[model samples]
Structures are given as C-alpha cells and as structure tokens.
Target: MIEVIRSALPTRCLYSHVVVSGQTIGAVTRIRYDGPGVMVPRVFGSVFFYQPSQKINLCYGEITESATVNQFAEVIAEDLDALRDLGSGVWADTVVNPVRHVVEVGIQEW
Candidate 1:
C-alpha cells in the first residue's frame, strides 16, 4: 500500500510526499504564478520508485502557458537517501521555476 501527503501555499504552490508502508520514497514540489491571460493547469514534476528491483525514474517538463494536462513533471530516485537529497528544499526559490507550475512525487514497492 502507498500513502500520500500534500500541502499547498494558499493555492499557487503545492508539495507532496509518497510513502510505501512506513518508508518515505518519493516527493514533489511546485509553484504557480498569476499571469494576465488564462493559463492551462499543468503538472511539471513527477517521482517514481520500485522497491522490488530497486528501480527509479524521474522526469521534469514545462507546458505552454496556454496548455493544460492531467499531470505534471516527475522525478524519482533509486533510494530513500537519494530521494531526500533531491527533494531537499526543492521549493526553495534558488531552484524552483519562476513561472506558474505544478509537481508530483511518488514511491512504491512492487
């Protein structure tokens, strides 16, 4: 089984973590900005991990300001330590995108 926890800054910023059983294996963070025109909602980050074989996958992307999608970019790590290192304060202004965006992170044992 997988458990997920999410937190957001008002409505523009979002952060989430995914845990398998009792171990944290994935996480996501995003920031959104207000623009003059109508923007399509999109996700810009992702995270995935497979414990059975110790496999990991991650991806990141950006969509046009007028485009929208059901999901967003994701990043994954091979282990808990790697995941923590990658997600460490990812929401920090020094690394996060300046534009409106969304991110998703997850981990699983299969």
Candidate 2:
C-alpha cells in the first residue's frame, strides 16, 4: 500500500518512511519545487532505503526552497516515524498500489 500527502507550498520538500509489522520497512526523502509560469516542476534529490523484512517500498524526489537541507533532514526523520506508524496499521485501503509511468498523481496531462 502507498500513502501520500500533498504539500500546500509551491516549493515544498518532504521525506517519509514506511514500516510494516513493527519493523522498519523503508525510508524516503525528497524535495519538490514548483516555479511560476511554464517551467516544469523540479525535484532536487532523494535517497531511499528498502528493507526486505517488510514488503513496503520507499521513494523520494525534488528538493524545495522552503526547507534548508538540514531542516528537510529533520522533516525526513519525522516522516520516517509517521510512515512506520502508518505501515504498521491496517491501511490496506488507505494506500495505493501504483502502476508504472502509465499512471501518476498530480498530473493534468498524463
């Protein structure tokens, strides 16, 4: 299952982790930026970790201006905690099982 949270900022950075069954399953950190005009959204960088004990996967993308790298790092830590909680719960219906490039979110012209 995949759970996603959208940011209200035009330039927002986020990090999260996924844990399953009381174990740390995965971790993700990303930064996303949205510029004015026709410019494409930018993803700064990301790092992820996937543990085999849990079937959950982690992903990160696009760094944002609102958070310094250090601040974002802190956010990432917090997200990991939240993800772990979410993953351990019975959230099969709250998460999404995504397809490849054929499917996506927040896109108008996919």
Candidate 3:
C-alpha cells in the first residue's frame, strides 16, 4: 500500500502549500507526477498545482532538499513556490508524501 512517511515539514506543507491552479477535476481525480528525480518522497506525490475543493484536504511532505524554498520571504515560501512550480522546479526541490493509508476509502467532493 502507498503511504506517507510522515515528517514535520511535509505535514506542514499539506496545509501551507495551498495553490489555486484553476484546474477543475472530475468527481474522481488522481494527480500524479513521476520521472527520474527526487522531488517528492514517493513516485506518486504532489508535484503539480491543485485547487482544493471542500471535499478532500490533506497533504504530508518533508523536504529533504530545496532550492526555491530559500528564495522566498517566508519559510513556507519554499512550500508555496515548490507547490506551484508544477513539473521541474518542484520535482527538484520538494518530496511527495501524503497522509498514511487513507486511500482505502478515498476522498471525494460533492
């Protein structure tokens, strides 16, 4: 089963790294990103932008390394920047680790 490794920074990123991608998803959605890199803690982690609905809300990420993080004014600027970078920038900086074993039930929006 896919699980989140759990860490302070990643736990913080879940709530702090909120982005309005203006991308609307279907009733069922699975955002995915993968390649030869170490941005996220998993092969399937939050590597792109997402606009949150009232339905599902939770993310867990721990930063083992970062570049854009240090560039912003706020410490979370790292998370913010990393979350918005989409493909490469985020892949280069952050690590993708979600909450532990919640996918069994899954999250949904009404």
Candidate 4:
C-alpha cells in the first residue's frame, strides 16, 4: 500500500505505507482530523486538477493525513480474525449467486 499527504501552503509532502491483502482488495478507510470542508452555496471544490506538461496536482488531502501507518495497521489487526474464513483466493469469486426468479423480479422492477 502507498499513501501521501501534501500541504499547499508549506509545499510539503508526507508519505505513508499501505497494507494490502486479497480479502480486502477495495477497502479504503480514511480518518480526518477536522470535519470535512463546508459545502456552501455557489462554491465548487474538487480533489485534483490538471496542469501543464500533462501533470496532475491534488488538492486538500487532509483526510488521508489523519490516518498514520500504524493506525491503519491497527484497523487491519482488528478485522484479521473475521477475515480468516475468507481465503486469499476466495475474494476472487462472486459470493452472491443469482437465481432466475430473482433476476426476473429485478428486471420487472427496472
């Protein structure tokens, strides 16, 4: 896993390590120190922007900064036991099997 925190005012960058496993392929949890930014009227905000030379710069990474490497590790440790039942390769398969009746019901609803 890989993570980074950048500050626009000080022009500083901080890097953190990420941990990955087969069981939690798409799990992403972020810890923010202060609350999220206010969403006022007529104000637009985004996470990234494009610059010249085909470069990309990110904006407002406070949420990612709140999670240190150790904190993330702790979260992983807490969930490790429950994850044991799911083998490394089990994540690759679909857990939700669809029956013809269910599919038909879903189609009717749509």
Q: After superposing candidate 4, which stretches have Cα over 4 Å from the reference?
A: 1-24, 28-73, 76-78, 87-92, 95-110
Whole-model lDDT, model 4: 0.22
lDDT of 1 by residue, 1-110 (tens): 11211233222223422222222223222322222322235333433333333222232333233323222223333453554454444424223343333644343333
Backbone clash total for model 3 is 9
Q: Per-residue lDDT for 27-100 in model 4, tens only?
A: 21232233222232210111221111111121111223321111111223444443333322223233343222
TM-score of each: 0.22, 0.20, 0.16, 0.19
lDDT of 3 by residue, 1-110 (tens): 01211111122222222333222111123323222223222211233222232112222234332322101011133354433333233233333443322112222211
Arranged by TM-score, best first: 1, 2, 4, 3
Ranking, lDDT, top scorer first: 1, 2, 3, 4
TM-score of 3: 0.16
Off by over 4 Å in 3: 1-75, 87-110
After TM-score superposition, the amount by which residue 32's alpha carbon in candidate 4 deviates from its true location, in angstroms, is 12
Clashes of 4: 1
Best by TM-score: 1
Q: What CA RMSD would you report for each candidate?
A: 16.9, 14.2, 16.1, 17.8
User: Which model, 1 or 3, shows the larger lDDT?
Assistant: 1
With candidate 4 superimposed using the best TM-score fit, by how many Å does residue 52's alpha carbon deviate from the native?
20
